[model samples]
Each structure stands twice: as C-alpha cells, then as structure tokens.
Target: MVKAGRVLALLLLLLSFGVTAPTATADAAPVLSSVWTGTWETAPSGTAPALPGAAIRNVVHTSVGGTAVRIRLSNRFGTVPLTLGAVTVALRRAGGGPAAVAGSMRVATFSGAESVNLPPGWDVLTDPVSLAVPAAADLLVTVFTPADSGPATYHRTALQTSYVAAQGEQRAADEDGTAYSAKIHYWYYVTGVDVRGTAAGSVVAFGDSLTDGNGSTTDANHRWPDRLAERLQGRRLGVLNAGLAGNRLLRDGVGPSALARLDADALSRAGVRALIVLEGINDIKGSPEASDPVAFVEAYREIVTRAHALGIRVVGATLTPYGGYSAFTAAREAVRQKVNALIRTGGVFDAVVDLDAVVRDPASPERIRPDYDPGDHLHFNDAGMRVLADAVEPAVVG
Candidate 1:
C-alpha cells in the first residue's frame, strides 16, 4: 500500500510539472509588433535649398493596419532649433496614386507654435494619433516647411519605385493647403515607427549601414529589413530598424554609437523581444582612434551582457568583406578577420549570422563578389542586400 501511494504521488507531480513547464515556454519572451528606421532629408541629392531657410519635406507610405500610429522624429544631428510645421498623415493608392483626401487624412499639428523646435542632440516622439489604416495601404506623411531648418533626415518608403519631387516643384495640397510633394530616397533620420496592434510585443534590428540600406535603390522600399517586415505580413510582430550609417559597435561616428544609443533606441522601446545586431565593420575600419582586435572583442562582450540583462536576445553578424575600397588595407583586413572570428566562436551571442561567409567571394575569399559589391566593395547593392536578408534564419528571429 505504501509503494502504491508513492507511485500515485509521483505520477501526479509529473503531470503538474508538464502542465506548468509548457506554460512557462509559451510565455518565453515578448515578441515584436512592427519596426522601421531611416532618415529625413531637406532636399534630394544635387539640389541645395536656402537655409534658415527652406522647408524640407518627404513622405512615409505605410500599409500597416492599426488604430493608433506613432512617429519618432530626431534632432540628433541638428545644431539649431528645429521646428516641424504642418505635419499631416494620409493614405495613397498603390504605385503612388492620388492621395485619399476627404475622410482618409489626419493632420498632426503643434498645439501652440506652427512648428515644434527640437534641440540639438535630442529626439522627440509625437503623441499617438488615432487613425485607421488598412493592410498594405500606402500612407503619405507630408511636412510643409516655411524655411530651411537644418539637415532634414528622412526614411524613404514607397511601393514599387518612385521619386521625391524636388524643391520649388508645385504639389497640390488638400482643402487645408498643408500637404506638399517632395523627392523620396527611403534613407531618413526620422528613426522609428511603431504600430499599435492587438499583440503584446515588438522587435528591434540593431545594425549599421548595410542594415540601413546604404546602397539600395531609393524610393524602392527594398531594404532587407523592409523585406523581412513584408514576410511577417500579419503575425503582429513589431519590427524597428535601429540601423545608422557609419555607426560602430565601440565608438561613435555617423550618429550616436551603438552602445550609447542602445538605451533610447532599443531598451527604451516598448515590448521589445529579439535584437538583430549587424554591426562592427565600421569599428574595424572607421575607428577614428585606433583598431585593436582584443579591445573590439571586449566591447562586443559587454554589449551582449547588457542586452541579456534586459531579457533581450542578441544575434551577432560577422562583418562583411571590404577588400577593394579606398579604406581597405592588409592591416584593416586582418583586424576585420579577427573580429569576425571572435563573433563566430564567442558564445556571447544567442545566435550568429555569418554574413561574411554568405557574401564573400569564393575566389578571392577576402573580397565581396563583384555581383554583390556595389562599386565601392564596402557596401552591398540591392541584390546583395536581398542575399543578406535571406541569410537571416527566420526561426532564430522569431
């Protein structure tokens, strides 16, 4: 009787453990809802507008369906007061068709001043506007400028390929005379956009220029990260691109350094799950101070540790090849190789994306394939960007 009682107790305990274990697994970690990052520009390349000055304008097209949309604008590089005037968000038809005026537009205006001044080195998020967006719908976000504020940073997004109307070009506004036309290049400093969905979490892509789509075709909306978002379609995973051009893992260059910006860019974001970190090339080649392989490894370790403490999963990407650029040198190449070796072998990262192995030319081994290398060999062309995006394992990301 004693033996039978003990057996029955053990069976009950095992059943309880099974039920509780699966519950813990189901709530493993928070998932992302949506994510995006880019820059806003005052004018298209080649044309210079007046300063103090000219009103810089661009548009954001979104197909993300939600009731509330949030816009994140940056003055991270601005030295003077930056005022944003006549901010409006609207929906457009496929292939840059006419805007959905009447009931489809929402104007985001400042309560007091026509424009909001952004102090240098700081960024601000607008209040969430209540708007209904449809799936795969294009949104046109227009900014009317009265003078040149500063360097306008923008993130370029358009269905298919399109162009941003240059300055002085007359664009028709709605009955309110607020919206205007401008050239588009998908690369903008505006940074992030989060769509409030029925889900509970979001994702952040922590990367550098490649992830920022340095050489991808402008207004085409073909950045690898963008492609990844399209793949998620309706999973309700929020994806935010925290990529900056000329950014590094250990030091600052084009924008705030990765480690320095992590808090505001990733940790501070609501309901963040996994972090896709595809940086370090700039650290290997563009470090203004000095390049030490050992020091680079230590910095990476610290980044991983900090992220893990926040319950975020870190996925490390091996630095891509840069063998033929003007900046390339045997010494720099050796440093890059060492860093890649550490990223692959080191157990710090939760997972690894072997971008180097995926993009490197078998013939040269140290150089990117001609087909994939944009003229400079340092950045990937659109096709190369696709390859890099495909290299990412969806299972690990989810």
Candidate 2:
C-alpha cells in the first residue's frame, strides 16, 4: 500500500509540473513501409561528345514494381560539369515513341532542387519521386541540359534505342515526345534506377558482351539478365545488368576492367544481395590476352573475396564457347579449356553456373550450339539468352 501511494504521488507531481506521462504505443516512432532496391541498371562503357541544350529520353526496363522510384546519373568520365536543367521520369506510353503515359510523369530532384550540376567523376542518385512503377514496364527518364556539358558518360550498347531532342531544345517536360524525334543507340548519363518497395534485394549480372546483349534485337530486352528478370518477377528481387560489350576482366576494353568497375557497377549498387560474374572470355581473347590460368583464377578468387566481404553471394559462370569467332586460335582454345577446368574445381565462388556446358555443342565441345549462336559464335541469340537465365540456381540468388 505504501509503494502504490509513492507511485501515485510521483505521477501527481509530474502532472502538477505539466509533463504528461508518455503512452507506450503513441510515443513510439512509426515504421517505414518500404526499402530501396535496384530495379534496372547499366554501367557506363565509354564517353560520347556532349549534346548541348538537348533533352535525352532514356528508355529503361524494370525488373520489379514499386510505389516510388529514384534514378542514378553519372559523370564518371566527364571532362566538365554536367548541368541538368531538369529531369523527369514517366511510364512509357503504350505505343511508345518516347512518349510518356498521361498523368504519370514526375519531375526528379536533387537535395530538393529541380536542377543540379555534376562535375567530372561525379556519381549521384536523384531524390525519390512517387510513381506507380510496374515490373516489366518501360520507363522514360528524360534529362534536359540547358547548356553544353562535358564528354557524356554512356553505355555504348544499350540494345534499347532511346530518344534525343534537337540541340537547344528543353523538352524534358514534353508529354507527347514530339520534340524527341531523334534517336540514339546509347544510354547517356543515366546509370541506374532504384525502387522503394518490398523487395528481397537485387542480383547483379556483371560481365562483357555476352552479358551485354550484343546480338540481341534492338529494344527487345532479350539479354540474359532481362530474361532472368522475367523469371524473377514474383520473387521480389530486382535484376541489374552490369555488362559492357567488349569489356575485359584483366584490362580495360570497352569499359574499365571488371575489377575496376565492379564496385560501382555491382558491389555498391542499391540492395545488392547476389552477384553473377560472367567475365574473363574477353581477357582470354583480347590483345595482351590473360591466357595464364593462374592469373585468371587469382582474379576470380579476388572477385569472390571482395563480394563475400559485403555478404553478397557470388555465382561464377564459365565462359561460353567462341570457336568460330575470328579471334579464335588453337592456343586460345587450350587456355579457355584450362580456365574452365579450374573454375569448375577452384571452389572460389559461392556457386557456379556452367554456361559453357549449357551452351556448348556436344559434337564440338569447344563450340556453341548452333541453335543458340546468333551467327557470331561469341554471342547468343534470344533463345540462348533464355537458357542462360534458366541455368541460374534460384536458391543461390534467394
């Protein structure tokens, strides 16, 4: 009875001082409903001459849906500042001529400002904008540059054609896209798009031309990663394609070396949970080829080590056959076989997907299956891309 009286007295004293007692649930903070995850991404493979005063509409495909979206733009190779007069994002119209769906466009901002500048070597993500993003849907990210900028960082083989307005035109806000009559094969400035939603995470497909969809139809989205995205639609995990055509593992070719760009293109991407590395073929065939199996194995081990440090599961894919490629030689073939043998036994990855085994012709073990080859032995056709996606172990990514 005395202890109860003391508790009452304390409460009364607090009331007298005008400090109300806190309620258990009411005083607690509200929980956030969604987390950010990467839905689509592309690495900048090289630089291009700037399009002064032009508005560019980059068409990107999504791997997952979300209530809101954000974009990443890079000037990682620029020589001067990238002045963005305005940036906007919208769902591509049904018929799609760079036009946006009505009432779906949203202006993007940085630090709450509609306009911002990115200097050389700069990489930034736009502030999130509310929009109903759907899986497999196309988005048109429009950027208007009111003045001349530096060499524009670009992904040379987007496989998807985007649009660009005439110089000195500011059509980023134009809904009809009539001003965006000119088309470009490259994805300029933009690098990635992240969505805020209930996603498990994302898988990064990091590699070279084989992964970059070099032989896939333009705007068809038939890249292996794109096919993988379709397979992962209901899994709530985004698939990011970090491939660069002609890219090498040991040295730069179409883009920075695999090791050099891994961090920016795969490791540090939004909500990365797994990594699919399909590189090394270029290194084995390109000039100053890294033919030594030891060198290649060491590089693969290094990749595994780096990815494991961040708790990312790494899946190593054996190099696909390229027998009929102009660059093929007996010595190179031996090196490829040696590397694949080591990769199958190295124990350097969390998992392994034998792309060579799946795509190689049984009759000519060193060559790709004819049905899968897209005339170029080094690249795959749409059907082959589907095979690559199906080869991945779903449990590994999950």
Candidate 3:
C-alpha cells in the first residue's frame, strides 16, 4: 500500500507538468484577433553601410497595443547572411530618440537564445515578451551585430530618425539614451512589430508615394493613413501603412510592383481584415502598359480576389488627379479617368473611398485643388491628408 501510494503521487506530479506545459504553450502562441504591424519599405540604394560590430536603434510607432509583443528582423535585401548579436525592446521616452522610459525595458530573444542569424533574403521573429504597450505609442528597438555584417537591408522615407553607433562600437545593449548620438532618416533590418489581443483586425493602406506621405511634414504622423489611424483611435481596428514611395502597379520600379509584393506586404500580416488600395498613379506616369487600363484593372482584380480568399475586404480609392505634375499627359489622364470610372462603377471593391472626388478641383476635374496640392501637384499637403483621412467611411473598414 505504501509503494502504491508513492507511485500514485508520482503519476499525479507527471500529469500536472504535462497539463500545465500545454497551457503555457497555448498562452504563448500568437493572438489571432488583433495585430499592430510597422511595415518596412525599401531603402534607397547604398543607404545602409556594412556594420562591423555596432548597435543600431530604430523608433517605430505602434497603432495598437496589447499585453505581449514580438518583433521581426529581415535580411531581404542583403547579399550575405546577417548575424544579430543581441536585441532589446523598450518604450521610448520621447520623440525619435534612443532613450527608453525607465523600467519599461525588456530583453528580446529568439527561440530562447540571445542571438540569431538571418540568411540572405529571410526574416525572423523574436520570442514574444510580456509587456504593456499603449496604442499610438512609440517603442525603441535596438540591435547589435558583432561580425562584419554585410550590406544592411533598410527602408528609407521613414520620416522618423533612427540612430546607429559608430562602426565597432558596442553600446547597443545599453538601456539609456545617452549612448546613441548619430542620426539617420531610415530603418534598418527591423520589419514589423506585432502585439497580441482580441481587438478587431488591422487595416493595411497599400499604395505609392501619395500614400507614403511624400510631401507631408516629417515626424508629424500627418500622412493620410496616420490621420485615419488617429480617427480610428480606441477602436478595435489598427492601420498599417504599406505604401512604398515610387512603387507602381504593373511592373517593378522603386520597389517590387504592387502586384508582386501584395502577398507579403498585405496578406501575410497577422489578423488583417481590410485593405485600402491607392496604386496606379506611378504606373500611369511611367508604364507603357498604363496607356491601356485593362492591365491595371486586371491587377486590381487579382488583388481583390486574393484578398477575399484570405477573408480580407478590399477598399478601392480612386486615383487622385496629377494633371499639373511633370509626368502628366493627356493620354495618361484618359487612362486615369477610365480607372476612376471603374472604381466608382463597383463590383471590384467591397467599398470605395473617392479620394479623387475629395482632393480634385471641382471646376477643373483633371487637376488637384490648390489647397490640397503641396507645390508638386501630385502629393497632398498636411490639411489635404486630413481631408483624405476623413473621407474614409468607418463603418466599411471592419
């Protein structure tokens, strides 16, 4: 009887561990309801230098918050394998700085290890860390590379400043802001940051320079999508800006063509419920194929079909007029009109946001309103961005 009792106690202990282990794994799994993604665009050629051992800090604003967070690092454009020495995440104390708020710092690891290696053309995610992040708040991510890390993968047009330590310096693991003094207007390696929650899914704004905030004030978060995020504050939906400046719809230009990158930039995101497409202007200005609206329309239709396959609704925004821009021509203008007519005629999109109607001059029809044009006649001014954001119907997004 004594031996049997001991055996029974051991069996119960094993069961407890087994049951609790699965529960812990379940808790640590990614939350499928809500996601806040900070997308990465291409950095101009030769923008990032090789790191022989340095610490780099990037500041990214979160559109939603939750109890746990994970970060993505990439070597998508690197020709050589990239080695990450260490990584850390902390809440920023102020605007575009390296400082983290006191007591809010957390160490991030990859699969229980402190370091990771990313092969050329790949991305990796850090193990989730328990942290309370607030919506629209900024977080500082610091990375250290110990080896002669080859050409860096980066995104220019961040509009927000990021910092890098001098070559061979190892201050990246420091928790304080004093060590980072150099500044650059781009993000390196870091791709997306995600938080776990039960909020309504995310909204991805996919477009070209117009949607990328080419003319908006830097660091002001005044991009139309930024304004839309501000308006959607406290709601379950978060907005992700996937606009790549100079990106096109038909063929590759500054970055991969919109059709080529759609799966990675929009569909691969966690918990995405809707997407707002504002492409084709670049194609109209540059591509020979744009002279015929059929290719552009087919590209958009493919996007809609693929998105719907993933349960994501598509919102189509009419191409804003660019009549006075240097690239504008009467032929391109006719194509633009045809595309806009198709967008308004329905069937391709779940909803329509008439940015053309909102920003175009009512009298001229083919030109941007004077107040909305920021000298370029293509991109919107700050107030114009606000108007574009306000034009989005909230009821249709979720």
| Candidate with maximal TM-score | 2
Model 1 spans > 4 angstroms off: 1-57, 61-64, 97-102, 109-117, 134-137, 145-189, 287-290
lDDT of 3 by residue, 1-398 (tens): 57988977854653332211111110122346544443222222222776667788888877777777888777767778788888888888864578888888888887677777676666666787788888888888888888877788777778787777765245765667776878877887776777776656678889988887888898787888888888877676678888888898989987678887787667776567789999999888885546777777799899999889878899999999998899988988999999999888957899999999988898898899999888998999898999999999888797
Off by over 4 Å in 2: 1-31, 167-170
Best by lDDT: 2
Candidate with better lDDT, 1 vs 3: 3
- TM-score of each candidate structure, all chains considered together: 0.75, 0.91, 0.88
Ranking by TM-score: 2, 3, 1
| Overall lDDT per candidate, in order of appearance | 0.59, 0.85, 0.77
Q: Once model 1 is optimally superposed onto the true structure by TM-score, how far is the C-alpha of residue 86 displaced, in angstroms?
A: 2.9
Compare candidates 1 and 2 on TM-score and give the better one: 2
lDDT of 1 at 65: 55
